[model samples]
Target: MNSLFLISSAIIIFAIAYVTYGAWLSKQWGVDPSRETPAHTMNDGVDYVPASAPVLLGHHFASIAGAGPIVGPIVAAIFGWIPVMLWIIIGGIFFGGVQDYGSLFASIRHDGKSIGQIIEVNIGKTGKRLFAIFAWLTLLLVVAAFVNIVANTFVSVPQAATASTLFILLAVFFGFAVYRRGVPLAIGSIIGVALLFACIWAGMKFPLVLSKNTWIILLLGYIFVASVTPVWILLQPRDYLNSYLLYAMIAGAVLGLLMYRPEIQLAAFSGFNVGGKYMFPMLFVTVACGAISGFHSLVGSGTSSKQIDKESDAKLIGYGGMLVECVLAVIALITAAYIGGDKLKELLSNGGPINVFSDGVGTFMTRIGIPLEVGKPFTALAISAFALTSLDTATRLARFIFQEFFEDKTKEKQSILVTNRYLSTAITVGLGGLLAVVGWQKVWPLFGSANQLLAALALLALGAWLANVGRNYKMIILPMIFMFIVTLTALVQLIIANIKTNNFILVLFGVLLFVLALVLIKQSYKVLSGSERKGMKA
Candidate 1:
């Protein structure tokens, strides 16, 4: 609950990791990224893009800074601030940062081929296909889980959905103008962004809330069209601009904490670790991004790689972005600490994560010069910004997974690229749509396991990558092993819980994920069983 203590802890731990562990890991697993940039290089400022290091950093941070920082800590704090704070700082800077930086350097040094491609390239073709299959299934869950998150955020603020819709429209115009016309991208970007804000303001003033059925249709339309659109306009720019919103929100939170030094209020603070039923099993899984996430590595390799300007940029984009997320987590901790236990339960049960966040952040801002009425809505808008960022990115990733699944290695015919991409979008969007409609009352419990399932998959992939890097395999082996054990333990608990609740759907889902984990472990081990890198040199 002490905002300063949380922030200081994160920074101090990050410093420790940077000096002792991060440096040692770099020495061990680090590879020269310069040589590989030539192959998958992009000369155009869009796909094969170049930007200043900071802008690229912003892109990476914005892409990764979704609802995780806000929701994870808030949910996990049921265990107590001490426990939540411990893992977030230690696990975040050490375990999470290493995974993210390693994944970035690995992918960048491999010419921006995805983690799946890196797994295959370094391991074997069969290994690569297996990784892709696991990734596909993981992406499906990502679409289902995150789309529901975005939908809920939007459902709370029906007017904000209009802002998202307008943002998409402007992206279409910007995409067409730059790609199909003679307009410079810089000029187009400015105009498009201005128009997007205009629409957001209009939406707020009018407060449009379409019927649930019509609302779902409109949202689906945006998903399919936006997912299929070229990345230059929407995906890249939306993420780029949204970073400002996210950062502003975080900055506001930090500034508010500084100006208004609120004491911690939870009775659970410094309490005994009486977890399990309260916050025991749920702690690590719910607070994913601030500590460790399997998803960031995917984004690091997949989309962020396309925009990186230079070799050393990996440090900025990966490591720096993660630090920013940790700070956001600290702010979230302050919110949890500020809102005591009883009110916290009321907030949780009432179903308004954004409002709780807004109330906390708004309190901080209110102490400063900002008015409460304005600051609260602005805080809510920031939540919407992150939610939308996650929504679009999840859609794109799911599309990538779907496309990768049907990627037949034929010379002349491109099956997945052309027809299969649309099919993939449909499948991905439909699954997300289904979740938005039916995935009710499923919060930290289900989503936590799902997110960790991703972390497990990522670690499994990391272990494979690290093994091929030869001398540095030990750097990742421990974390990978730890996450593997944790996943196995959590999987067991998940199955038992499902049985008790008589939720056959979740039981089946958890079992399927468990099998995927086992398969990935077996496949990764098969490749890493004293095998040499079989990649064709570009």
Candidate 2:
């Protein structure tokens, strides 16, 4: 099969999903443009400031589209291209898109609160607290995995590290230029872009090499500062800027696919077993962010919801953003397929998933006459940028959850310390840093399960919210059920795997996630089955 055929097919399917299915969903959910968004009503020139459609979409997409789409699809392609492609398209549209859109819509309706808070309104406070803890832990895993991954990249690929460091500093400058000095966004963006390319050039010329452990410590310090700082200072403007780089990378890869139109050399199906794990559940977990990540729900509800300018914009920023990510995942699967299975396994053994994607994308770029030297650093820079942006976002989100968890208690106790912004950020980053040290090997499997489980729980929260609003919620409910089952299977697998390997910490974490899922499921079932619906009635 020609790569162009697959690429074209994915493009057609995504368009149809956006136009027909996405529109139908928007209509079904009764998206009202005139409704006041929390961003506008709660504007504080900080976390709650309203943003234009494009800016919000860029930040949202950049936050959620991290390494997951690239890493997940390529890793799971071991099961075969057919399964991975089908999941990325079908699951992305029907599951991930709905979850993102629904979570954003629900959060907007609830004063830009997180899914945890939404659960409190629909279920109860205890349920919300439980969900909040789960969210915080999962986000911790995200921070740990991402920090280690970024640090490893910096250690192994010094030019990428140099480029990433430049990206961060320029992002801060961009933020200050636009928000503080009142520079026009267009001018600031142009300056930022120019500086970005210069950074790439400089990175190649004067690479900043560091050991992995040193990089990890420095990254943790950076996260602490980034998280505690106001959103406008670093998170939003930086993410918006990095988002453009990500968009360019995607566009270039798509063009390469069209220009090269290489034949698929990988097997279409690799039976029902891959790397000693059964295909049914492992594939779903492995291909998580590429298909239906729970992490996205956190981002959509936790951060993006606060910045949306209008209710209707949620559909575009949330649903549309996810479909674009699905396209990237498709491109990743194609990269693996073109590289062939044995070569991919070798790449995994030698350099890891990041190397696999960079090498594959670099190879494609080479096919189109771009030299490997240029393509390699460019691809690495893109991936590192993706991870770095996600790192701060996740750190910030974890801070939010910590503050939210302690808000009422602190108020009741008349204590300002627990909810202090700096304190919360410090605690969050500290825990994540600790886990990143010991949980390096354990984070991926555990993170995948926890993340998907979070998604299932988030869907249930959204489903409950939809029910409260008296909207047609079958769309929300079906995906909720599917994710619930898939996540449960993953948790069970991890529990068994961890126990056999004597990894008690991961085993405990897996069991805790399973229990939390059960609790959320019970709450959702009661609401959906009408038994608990009357109690939640407004």
Candidate 3:
């Protein structure tokens, strides 16, 4: 029941999986090192710029990690650390990693298209449209939920707000210097990280206090600009720099846990039914990002695939990135388990899971000679930074989906609404802003269900594509089927719960997403069946 044992075990398992299972997947999917990737062939300095493996990994990991691995595991701890831990390790390797890896690989092959566009190529145009609608709607939920979470964090921890602002300004300069001014990456990175730490110290000295609503407004405006700007100027560099904060936090936590070795205070199992929620589907849905998420596929296909220098980097950024998140999820579970029952409840009620994680990690840092005052705020700042990363990344991806939805291949010139980047981004962020005021608590359950369902659809698309190409698609079958059942069940429960509470808006969305899933599944099934028949004849 020692925390060190649990965390160390997870690290070892993930490391082994990265080399063995991850490499095996690359080979099975026919990763061609000699082939030119979209980043090189379609090199537009805007979204399609090529990046080294490390830079893309940082961007990919930061965008996908967000508050997901931390929030989901801590929140789902109501079902006990045992079930949550099992899912993080098992589900992360087989379900999440494969989906992320496959999605990225698939996108690069199809000219750096989003998963929805990939669906269009492999399944059909109708399948692509349906998937795009579902994916965009799910992204809206992501924008709303994370916007609320980050705004609240800024309100409660003003120093983190100050630090995050500094991080943004620093990233802009770093991007210009490294990408435009010909500053060497290694030296630029050294200066960037050093100044990043200074931002934290300066944040503590001069906190930027603001109301939650005010922060929400400012954040919406920030993502609007972030979504339309060139990736190298903001998105890529910001994520790359912010990644160091996470790396330091993780390293510090592991070092502290090794030295401190706190005992697991929570019970192994808290029963299948706790607080009128059944663990069957709720547990699977709640522990999403840590285990598997539909969202990661978006980050992989939507952004990272566009910047990849070669096909070889996809496995590292996709599969290896997911395993790294599983490590963070394990650390999050331990933080909750170490806090025991009463304090965990109090923290959840007051500041939510982020507070619980911050406090636990703050205590861990004490063993390594860091004070709680500094350590806790630093953890808060790191997490909020990533949440902000997800916010803007989601906005960009949503814009991509929205534009893709309106795209007509038959037309030579697209409409302004679709071609105009600002208009599309404004529409996406504006809708998400309206929902941000609804609060994350009201939106999380439906988001979880829809997010998982998105994963199922992505898996379905991957399966159909592999089968169509006569590749070995058996690896994708079980995860795709399991996600469909889990997410569909979760959506049903959410609909019933929303109706009882008289929340018709969420109920409507839940029903719409459900219908969309069924229709897409039917479309994909035909493709799979036809491919099987073709193979039999050949």
Candidate 4:
């Protein structure tokens, strides 16, 4: 029940996974440093720009480490610390890290294309289209969910809104300074951080409050611009700046844990039933990005793959990033457990998960002599930063999927309008905004199912790719099957719940996802079988 014991356990396991399993997978994938990476080979300066390992690592980690890790564990702690810890460590090491690394590996090898495109190469065009559509929908939920979450935080948690608004403005300033004015990253970052801290200070002193609907509209507008802008202009720079904040938050959580060393107060096992849902699938679905997330694959292939400077960096960025997120999830779990069940339930009554996280973390900070007024807003700022990074990143990735969906079949020259960035972004943001507005309650469960399902499909695609190339694929295949089964079970449970409640919208969505997953699995089997037969013939 000691927090230090749990924290140390997670660190040791994650370290082993990275040094052993991650390294072995890298070798099996044949990550050759001598070979040109997509970023270098296709350096276009806009989307495909070669970046240093540190910079790209920042972007990759920030994109993947969304509210999922923080909120998922907090909510799932209802089941107890043991189950959440077990899944975050075990699933993170074996399943999440593998999926993320495989995704980045496959995408880099395929000229920075997404896992959906990788599926097409290995599983055929139909598989690709189905996967792409599913990915797009998953991302739509991502955008909607995160947008709503961020907007709510801004409305209810005034300091969060202040910090986030400053963060976005600081991001644009940093981007412009570095890219346009030829300012060095070190200097620009220094100024940005200084200004950021000032904003944080100002936020605490003069918080901005708005209505939830108003915040939602403002967030949607920001998403539209952020999505449409070139990568260098906003997305990359913003994530990079935000990454520093994220790292500081992570470090702060560790420091607080070390200083306070609170005991885990929640039950080790909170029984099979918590909050009206069975713990089996709900736990898995709830504790998603903390353990594993399909969305990481999209971020990996969608943006990070295009910016990676070398193939050697993929493992570090992809696998290491997930491990770091796992660490954050563990921290979140600790914070939530220490907060006690009654306190958390009370916090949830007023605000969303951000309140739970901020309240928990703020309590820890208070133990270290920081006032709740300061600690609470600071933690809220961290949560808002996390969610907003995901919002823009999701919107941008959705844009990519939208364009990929309409790619010219004949390989002929396509019109600019057909492949226009703004147009694609408009469609992506528009759809996500609409969903966020109406489907707020309906999206989370469906999102969790779809998100994890995407991880399974990505793994299947990676396994198929590895098989065709004649490599050891057991590492990929086993995890693929496990996630597929877990996600399918989650989807089924969701379907039954929706039916009982007569939530036909979710029911329809669940059924569609089930069918898509079935088809993808069938195609994967065919691809693997065909590859085996070809090998025998040869």
Best lDDT among the predictions, by candidate number: 3
Could you tell which candidate, 3 or 4, scores higher by lDDT?
3
Choose 1 or 4, whichever is better by lDDT: 4
User: After TM-score superposition, what is the CA distance of residue 4 in candidate 2 from its true location, in Å?
Assistant: 0.6
Query: Model 2 residue 377 lDDT?
Result: 73
Ranking of all candidate structures by their TM-score, best first = 3, 2, 4, 1
TM-scores of the candidates in the order shown: 0.87, 0.96, 0.97, 0.95
After TM-score superposition, the amount by which residue 206's alpha carbon in candidate 4 deviates from its true location, in angstroms, is: 3.4
Task: Quote the positional error of residue 503 for candidate 2 in Å.
Answer: 3.3
Model 4 segments more than 4 A misplaced: 180-182, 367-369, 415-417, 530-538
Residue lDDT tens for model 3, 238-301:
9999999899999989999999999999888999999998999999899999999999999999
Better of 2 and 3 by TM-score: 3
Give lDDT tens digits, candidate 4, residues 1-538. 7897888888888999899988998888888877888888888877888777877888898889978898899889888889999999988998999999989988998889998888887888898999888898888878888887888777777887887788777888888888889998788878887887887887778889889989889998998888777777778887888888788777776777778888878889988997687888789888999988999999999999998888899889999999999999998888778767677678878875767777777777766778888777787787688789888888888888888877866879775645798888887888888988995667566888888898898889888888777777888777888888888999898898889999998899899999999998987896676634224100
Off by over 4 Å in 2: 409-414, 534-538
What lDDT tens digits, residue by residue, belong to model 1 across residues 263-337?
888755544345544354457777888788888888887767766666666776777678778878877877877
lDDT of 2 by residue, 212-243 (tens): 99999999999999887767777788788888
Top model by TM-score, which number?
3
1 or 2, greater by lDDT: 2
- Model 2, poorest ten-residue lDDT window? 409-418
Q: How many steric clashes between backbone atoms does each model show?
A: 2, 0, 0, 0
